[model samples]
Target: MHVLVVYESLWGNTEQVARAVADKLGSVGTVDVVDSDAAPITVDGYDLLVVGGPTHAFSMTRAATRAEAVKSQSALHEPARGIREWLNLLGRPSAAIPAIAFDTRVDKPRMPGSAAKAAKHELRSMGFGTTVKQETFRVHGYEGPLLDGELERASAWADEVIAALGLGSRADR
Candidate 1:
């Protein structure tokens, strides 16, 4: 199976989790890990899609125009870019593929289910099957030293995805 893992990261915590997911998913099949900024991804070539982002101020970032003309004005209104805009720009996949959603967020003991919830809603609206489920990797500080052992946790999560999806060769079992 071919899997594509795409992500957006402000401070690299999300990137670390994306890498761990890609690495673990690769253990079962071919995987391509991409930064969401690299546009025009061919989702038709892959069997699984994994989307990830970071939670900022309890919401996913809102998409914005790049030109300076709207920057100041949009900054006041939009704030951040959400994966929904990115997926919308990419358009819906040609075929419905199973997908997993994830995010990296500050481990505030109080804050719960913001980014992952947003990601799942966006992905389901895009017409992907909600098989792999939404998950979160922890980040300690804003810039993220990354909660220790989160990568391993991500790998373990991916293993569950593989088993649930029945991916991997016979030998992999």
Candidate 2:
């Protein structure tokens, strides 16, 4: 299974989760991790897509929110287009491409909204099938060092995604 993992991280917390996910997927097959800004418009030649970002204001971050993250908040990089915009502008795939969505959020407050849920909805609307359940990794606060063992859990989630999707290592394949 060739997996393309795209992510938008404000303070590198989300990137950590993405990396853990890629590590597990790499065990099964080839994997590439790309920042959302650099991801291809068309997701072709890949068997699976993994999209994630930090939840901003209960959902995916927008231009204004990203700007705030860089200016008013503690994000290290300059503000730019994020997963929300990338998914919006993504070209439809020629064939059915399955996807999994994940996000990083504050672990303390237990927010109601989820970026993972929103991202999966967008992918489905764009004709991508989702075989695995959406997930949320937690952080201490907005610009945060992730909580303990979240990376391990993210890696384990990747394993579950592989099992659920049956991408490879199946007798049929």
* Predicted structure with the largest TM-score when compared to the true one: 2
Superposed by TM-score, candidate 2 places the C-alpha of residue 57 at a distance from the truth, in angstroms, of: 1.0
Query: Worst 10-residue stretch by lDDT in candidate 2?
Result: 164-173
Q: Candidate 1 residues 1-173, lDDT tens each?
A: 88888887766678889998898888777888877776344588889888888765565655533222135323222313346566767667789988888888777654755667787787788788886678888887555668889999999999998889888653766
Tens-digit lDDT track of model 2 for 49-85: 9999989898999898888888887689643779999
Q: Summing lDDT over every window of 10 consecutive residues in candidate 1, give the lowest-scoring window.
A: 66-75
Task: List per-prediction Cα lDDT, in the order shown.
Answer: 0.74, 0.88
**CA deviation > 4 Å runs, candidate 2:** 168-173
Measured against the true structure, the TM-scores of the candidates, in listed sequence, are: 0.82, 0.94
TM-score of 1: 0.82
Q: After superposition, how far is residue 168 of candidate 2 from its true place, in Å?
A: 4.5
Count clashing residue pairs per candidate: 5, 0
